[model samples]
Target: MKKEIPLAITFISGVLLVLALFIPHKPFGNLEEIFNDWYIIVSGFTFLLGIDSLLGYNFGKLKRKEKDAPYALVLILSFFITLTWGIVEIVRTPEHNPFGPTSTFSLYFYNSIFIPLQATMFAILSFFIASAAYRAFRAKEINSALLLVSAVLVMLGRIPLGQSAAPYVITVIFLIFAVYFFAESAGVTEPKIKIAYILVALIFVALIYPLGFVYFRQHIPEFADWIMNVPQMAGKRGIMIGIALGGIAMSIRIILGIERTYMK
Candidate 1:
């Protein structure tokens, strides 16, 4: 009975929410407002539930004397401290608290703790990326080799040297990277020709690149931007479509009451 009741509610609410979009008048005119109110109520309760779960988790860890117990304790203390400060501010100046995104507590926390921690994370991420890229760019497989080659092109076209290089010079360098990588898989079978191909390209760049930079340094960043805006945007759009379709399927599942995981 308990499960059936919630499932029925989900199905009806989901249908009504969908209907409200297309039929926003008369019998269902107020569905949007009604549903939004319900959402606000549920969200309030959900926030409290999340807080309860967070504390319960850390308390359990503390009780068990886990090796990471200190971090758990810090998490608990930080949550309560931030919550208490924000709550106190809200109660003290209800009207102003609406704009309290700039409140002293908010500003202090964002600048002193949040921003510094976020910057530190990015700094750590750079080293992790370098190591991962080293492992990935070994050209072990066709796919990884392609990824490595594309990545190298993108990187070369992005940095100051690439940015300073002349337009034609940059294009030639990119072509060389592609050709050199392909020489590995194409059964070229001739080592001397492959070596000569790369060495000649390098020598050419070494000689002409400075002249190109002196004359055409302005076009390097533009070339990189073109690659990203054209090819990268196409890939991103395809991914977004996939995400939207997945969301629609999930919504249908919920509306049909096939997704009961949320109730549990």
Candidate 2:
């Protein structure tokens, strides 16, 4: 009964919502709004349940005298303090309640503390992201080499001195890779051939340094802009389309009762 009722409710809600979207007239016209209100009401109760779970878990840690009990206590106290402050603000100044744009809570708690803390968290996270990107950008193959080149271009393009310095940076990068490849050619059984390869690489870099510097110094930013506006944008749209299609598939499965993971 429990499973059947919920599944039936889900199917009905899904089908009705789909109908309401396509046929917005009379009975179906207000279904979306009605369902949204019901959802909000249900969400409020779920929020209470979340609070209960949070507090209960923390209190259990405190009771058990765990090593992380202090941190748990801090979290519990902070939650109550913030909640109490919000309630007090709402009662004391209903017009400029805690959640309002110009309220004390917005200024002091949200903007002052929360915003800075969030920024700091993201700043810390960027190091980890950079570390991951370093591994991903390693030029093990042709695709990765292109990715590395594009990433370097995009990064340099965004910086203030990137235009002026990009030429030198790119020249140095080419020189390094040339030297690396020249060194890797130690397996060349003949000294003449090995020296010839090194000479060719050096000459190539020398030529590239002059011509590429002149051209890229003027056009690197534009090239980066094109990469971002075209290639990056296309990739992003493709990903969003894939996500939308997947979401639709999942919704259909839920509607048809083919997916019963929620019941479990």
* lDDT of all predictions: 0.76, 0.87
TM-score of 1: 0.65
Off by over 4 Å in 1: 24-34, 79-110, 166-222
Model 1, residue 16: displacement in angstroms? 2.1
TM-score of 2: 0.81
User: Candidate 2, which segments miss by more than 4 Å at Cα?
Assistant: 83-107, 188-211
Model 2, span 1-264: residue lDDT tens: 978889999999999999999997978999999989998999998998999999999999999999999999999998989988888888888888687667877678788888999999989988999999999899898799789988998988888898898888888768766777687668787878888878867875886666458877888889889999999999999999999999999999999899999886
RMSD of each: 5.6, 3.5
TM-score list, all predictions: 0.65, 0.81
Per-residue C-alpha lDDT of model 1 across residues 1-264, encoded as one tens digit per residue: 988898888889888888878996876988888778988999998988898898999999999999999999999899888888888888987765622566888778888999999999989998998999899888767688677756755676777676544456545645665466555535556878777666755665565545345534655456557778988889999999999999999999988888778887
Q: How accurate is candidate 1 locally (lDDT)?
A: 0.76
